[model samples]
Target: MAARPGYRVAVPRTQPEQQAPPVQRLRVRYAKRGRLRFTSHRDFSRAFERAIFRARLPMAYSSGFNPHPRISYAGAAPTGSASEAEYLEIGLAQVLDPAEVHRMLDESLPDGLDVLEVVESPGGSLADLLQASRWRITLPGAGDLNGLVEAFLAAETVTVERMTKKGLREFDARAAVLSLEAQTSGDVTVLDVVIEHVVPAVRPDDVLTALASVGEFPTGIVPLLTRVAQGPLERATGTVRDPLTPAS
Candidate 1:
């Protein structure tokens, strides 16, 4: 091989690869409630890494010039919405009690973002185990939405459009909805829905769009959506089981 005149070849640098697996791994379920629900995913991730450091956790890091802690997150609820079953997994360089980890991290994180449960991973991927999500959406002053929900469910397919980073796209929102029901929570009317995991994930807002298309949804009304649970779906019951709970 010969070098071209006035041209220099650049060799790509390779960083050392991580050699050992973490001594301990833990899966955690947490909640984003109240004002903290407005926190974006990036903001939460940065805060979490800081919490790990502040808690003096022996977190496992990747091997490189810029090593990042080995923390894996499952599908996160959209911003501006609360969640009770957000999930993440962390790798640790040392073994520790799962309960103790939960207690310490819960104390370290800011209020409104609480750690609900922690379990030692039994050697499996958390992402693969999660199959669906259940949500509760409250619409204040919107009146009864039972007719709209019934119409949306009766249809074979209810398409909705939303502006995404890749431009406006259309998808069938009805297909992902496993169950939809209207219930009263004190003074507010709530829509309890269970949605199966699918590509281009359907959000609570998309479901609302479908409802608006089918029936009357009062204008000037804002919806409060909260992800109630996310984990393995029970097809018979159309509900998601807690990942932290052992299968019966």
Candidate 2:
């Protein structure tokens, strides 16, 4: 566009954006607690980018017109669900001490979105290591939750329908469930669940729907679902180990 006689003409860039490739990758373990649990993954991404800026991190950026920080998120918990274990990886232009980065980022991010741990990634896939999750669901004023669990497990296939971007589809929620048990503490019924990561990842709501169909599920009462841990499942004892730890 031409400028007027007195107006200054804006100069267009002739060169592509230059950005450095990542020299190091750091894996982060964080928690979503309190009201921040309602923050969606997209929301957290934006918050994290801002935190990176505020913390002045030496983040590696992609090359081209729209260069962005090299950050990858794996196994995000569902929105409106509290989580003790969430994971992400960030590529850096310069290598930094994980502890230092952790402190910087923790201070930068908002309260309730806590950075629990940061470690230099060993050579392996973090996604591959996150094979399963241990989840806790609290049902208030619940009765006979143990019976419902037994009924759910006894079934060969417990199918539930969930509406996806593709539309509503039937899913076998029982298949991914490695273990499901309930323990009552006074008036509250607590559910301990270990579910394997599978295609068409099952959410806690799916399990609840399956339970509703298989047994008596308390209506008009919301369940408190929280992901306690995420990592590879130990087959022998049926536990989820920390994903960041390298195998011996």
Candidate 3:
């Protein structure tokens, strides 16, 4: 072969690097009902992962060969009870409209799971800002709910002895209780309470301990417990999807 004359290869110009879209973190509020209520925290997390897979949610993953989805749960309610307020934060691969995400999640969920709200979670994780939670509990009987609240309030310190995994522990029920009030409509009496879910966390059994101290909770029947809201951070603190309203 004839030797070709040496020629310099043309250098290609580098185009400006494109930036990836910003990842979005969102808070999703969902409900647990029916047989699903009995699911433990781990079970719920697993279920959510499967449902997300089924829903084909645009979940963002950590950078690794075996990447995990970026999801964080606020906390879990006790097993075998229904909850109206439960929340989790998930990072999305792409920023989608909150309304659209909400609708999609609702459709993707199995029976007894309801998507209540989807909003932008800014600045803090649910674990950080969740100082307290509100619950409305209804005992089995029409028995004196008002008296129970009054008794619960009058006590200087209500103590509940619980057996944790570590050992027997005593918690001040009064300290956990922020507000306790009673309301009656038709046949049932409702005990609406806002309690401090302190660091170690208070269980529904702890509340029952307080109630049982005042008076017996309707035996054999689990009380109806519904979590209404959670946060130390207010609507003013972050970018909430809805219009701000004064905390009640």
Model 2 Cα displacement at 166 (Å)?
Answer: 0.6
The digit string of per-residue lDDT tens for model 1 on 1-248 reads 67899988887988677645689999989999999999999999988988898899999887767778899999888999999999999999999999999999999999988999999998787997789999999888777778888899999999999999999999999999999999766668889999899988899999999999998788987899999989998998887998777789
lDDT of 3 by residue, 1-248 (tens): 55558966667876544433339988888889888888888888887888788778788876544568888887567787688778788888888998988888888777787888888866454665666677777765656677777888889988888887889888787877777788877767777777766745676557777877888556665577766665563334321222112235
lDDT of 2: 0.92
lDDT of 2 at 52: 98
- List the candidate 1 regions with Cα displacement exceeding 4 Å: 1-19, 185-187
lDDT of each: 0.90, 0.92, 0.73
**In candidate 2, where is summed lDDT lowest over 10 consecutive residues?**
12-21
Model 3 has a clash total of: 0
Tens digits of per-residue lDDT for model 2, 37-154: 9999999999999999999999999888888899989999999999999999999999999999999999999999999999998857788889999999998988768788999999
In candidate 1, position 13 carries an lDDT of 85
Q: What are the clashing pairs of model 1? A: none
When 1 and 3 are scored with lDDT, the better candidate is 1
Quick one: ranking by lDDT, best first? 2, 1, 3
- Return whichever of 1 and 2 wins on lDDT: 2
